[model samples]
Target: MFRSIITGSGAYIPTEIQSNPDFFTQPFYSNGLLLPSSSHDIVSKFKQITGIEQRRYVSQDLTAGDIGAIAARNAISDSGINPEEIDQLIVAHNFGNVAAGAIQSKAVPSLASSIKHQLGIRNPACVAYDVLFGCPGWLQGIIQADAFFKAGIANKALVIGTETLSRVSDRYDRDSMIFSDGAGAVVLEYKDTVSTDRGILSASVQTHALEENGYISMGSSDFPDSDPQVQYIKMKGRKVYEYALLNVPAAMKDCLDKSGVPIQNLKKIFIHQANEKMDEAIVQRFYQLYDLPAPVDIMPMSIHWLGNSSVATIPTLIDLVKQGQMPEHKLEEGDVILLASVGAGMNINAVCYRY
Candidate 1:
């Protein structure tokens, strides 16, 4: 049987580190009113809830496409495949190329095209495109690549998720602390595997746009005097938490069931690094469905330091673990793992994969 397998992965982490104390001097607002709590208390509570002590932000000169291409180059080099041989190049991003201090996103040629040009990929048959599926964008790209491989339209693909959430975040919103910047890429190749236990097995994706679409949205800054014409990332934190807690676990369970992977065999879960508590709860509930408690170290988290880089989280986590950066979490041959995510559009998805 033909299967799509990830051959190489890479990630680009920003150099600038913005720690929790960096926001102490910055004022925060809610409902056009200054927060009653002091910055110290607010930051402390924020860390308690989200588990983010610091996050990376790109230097002023960098753009999402730039970082994405760096990651893609690394992935290609890791795969030991010539760039001209790649069949498809998929770039997953939200705010295309938001400048350091700008609210506008420059995506005229599409981020994928931009990355393609930057990489000097001369093959026209290597079609490149962009996807905007919220935080699940990278995984969604993987799903699409799998479809293309099965359909015989492509045999090799490169998927990248890049975001500069720090550029789109509202400085006056406390939730801004959850935003970061990073890029990740993976090279996938179609192979004829004698067994079905070594590649992507199954996936489940859902979009609840009716009532949950507005949970994570864009709006004017919380500071009353800021220009209303400009928009920034905003979220109904409680609503998102509740929605994800209720739905993500079920989606994961469905994917696992379809893959026929026994519950006890799930070695690692690389979930989106949106919120620490929310992810923990979702995984715990996922295990509960099988009448078992969630296993320790089943989930390797980078949120405490990386924060939420939107679509870049899962792939970046994979690259880190693959590179042996995370000593406590490592993938071995024949290990079964799941990749899951939830984000704006109220989209949720899970992929069952074997290493």
Candidate 2:
């Protein structure tokens, strides 16, 4: 069996860190009946709730594609691979540069072309495409790239997850408090001989309760309303929390079982950095529900600092790993790492990688 290996990873966070004070001062919430709270109140509430100090957001003119391109270039460079060697580029994003038009136009290809042009990668084999699956998009992209490499259809591929969630965020809604903007990318390469050094071990994905609740915002075309408010993201926070807390740990166990490994054997655990409280709750419950040892190896909760960058969370974690910010938690050869996430569409995914 051909296994997928992650060669290099990179992440781009905008330099502009937006504090809660910045959010409260904006005039976007002025018209709402509930007066905007003071900056101190907002900051204290957010810090207590999410455990995040600050988050990065793009400047007014930058798009998701711009952040994605930067991350992609850095990933390619980090892998010691020339851009021309890339055979495919897969971008997982909920927001892109262009508005979805009437006739099936996706912005991924264009974004890929722009990246290729800027990097001077003029290879004829280059192909670019986009996948939209909310937070699980990057996990799906990893599985897709692995399958393609296994089939010998592509020698090298780049998978990226970028989201300018602020663009779709309802500034007036407190639910928006948990979202921020960023991008992350990883380079995958095919190798005939599998080594114990690095690569994916197993992956599994499942969906439950995919009904389109008002919680997840579909594009404007789905609703066909001129009201700008409807276009912004809205969610039933408690409902989503219920789904996440229940589903994520189960998915993690499933992936570990499929890989013939025990959850206790994992060297590190990377869950979607959605909510800090949810994260803590899941950890506590997983121990109680399964009679397993508590997960001691945990990655930093990025949502508080990075906000929910949708699918970018794991890849950004990868960047942090490479940067030595996350101390090596005994991830040795043959040791396993688990990645899990849940997103809109009520999707849940889990994958195990052996390093």
Candidate 3:
């Protein structure tokens, strides 16, 4: 059987840091009304709920595609494979290449094509495309690459998730504190192996779009007197929390079951860095589905310092831990892990893999 195996990973965390204290002087608003609460109180509540003390922002000179290409270059180098050998290149993003200080995003060239050009790969056989599946987009790209491998159409693929949420965030909205910018990439190759235990094993994905479609939509700034023509990322915080808490756990359990792996053998979970509390709650419920207590440190978290970078979260987290930059978390041979994410589209997906 042929299996898709991840051979290399890389992440580009923005260089500019925005700490919570940085927002103390900025006025926040809700429903076109200035919030009466002091900035200190609002920031305190935000930190408590999201556990984000700081987040990275792209430099004023960079765009999403630039950073995505940086991460992709690193991943290709890490894989030690010639770029010409790659049969597919997929880039996952939410807002496309939103230039710094701009509200509009451009997708005409396709972020994947841009990144491929930046990487200087000359093979015309290398197909490049983009996937916009909300924050689960990167995983969706990986899933798609795995399908291509199974169909014998592709042997090597490069998958990336990159986003510049800060570029589209409404500074007047308190949810702005939850946004960040980053890029992550991974190289996957199909191997004809006698054993199915290694590489990607099973996966599950779900999207609840009926009433959930508007949970994370774009709207004019919440600040009164702001231009209504300009749109910024708007989210129904409570609705998203409730929806993710309700559905993500079940989807994760379903994927794990499909992998035929026991709960006791699951080593780690690299879940999307959305909200710290919501992620913990979802993991707890997932364990409960197996009638077991959620194990200590079973999940490695980066939201405390990275904030939520939408599509970039999971892949970045995996790259960080894989590179040994995260001291408390590590991935060793024979380790079994699950990658899961939920976001706009109310999309949910999970992948079971053996290292």
**What residue runs in model 2 are displaced by over 4 Å at the alpha carbon?**
24-43, 98-110, 192-197, 209-213, 218-230, 328-330
Model 2 TM-score (2 dp): 0.86
Query: Model 2, poorest ten-residue lDDT window?
Result: 97-106
Tens-place lDDT per residue, model 1, 115-188, is 99999999999999999999999999999999999999999999999999999999899999999999999999
**In order, what is each prediction's RMSD in angstroms?**
0.8, 4.1, 0.9
**Candidate 3 off by > 4 Å:** none
Per-residue lDDT of model 3, residues 258-318, tens digit only:
9999989999999999999999999999999988999889999999999999889998999
TM-score of each: 0.99, 0.86, 0.99
Off by over 4 Å in 1: none
Q: Taking the tens digit of each residue's C-alpha lDDT, what string does model 2 give over 1-355?
A: 3567778889998877876667656433323444457655765776787776677778776677878889998898889898778888888887566332212224745666666666677788988778777788888888888888877799899999888777676666666667888889999887643445457778888777545344476433222223543556566677888877777777777778888876667777777788888878776665556686575555555666687888888899778876676675434557678888888877788889976
- Residue 59, model 1: lDDT of 97
lDDT of 2: 0.74
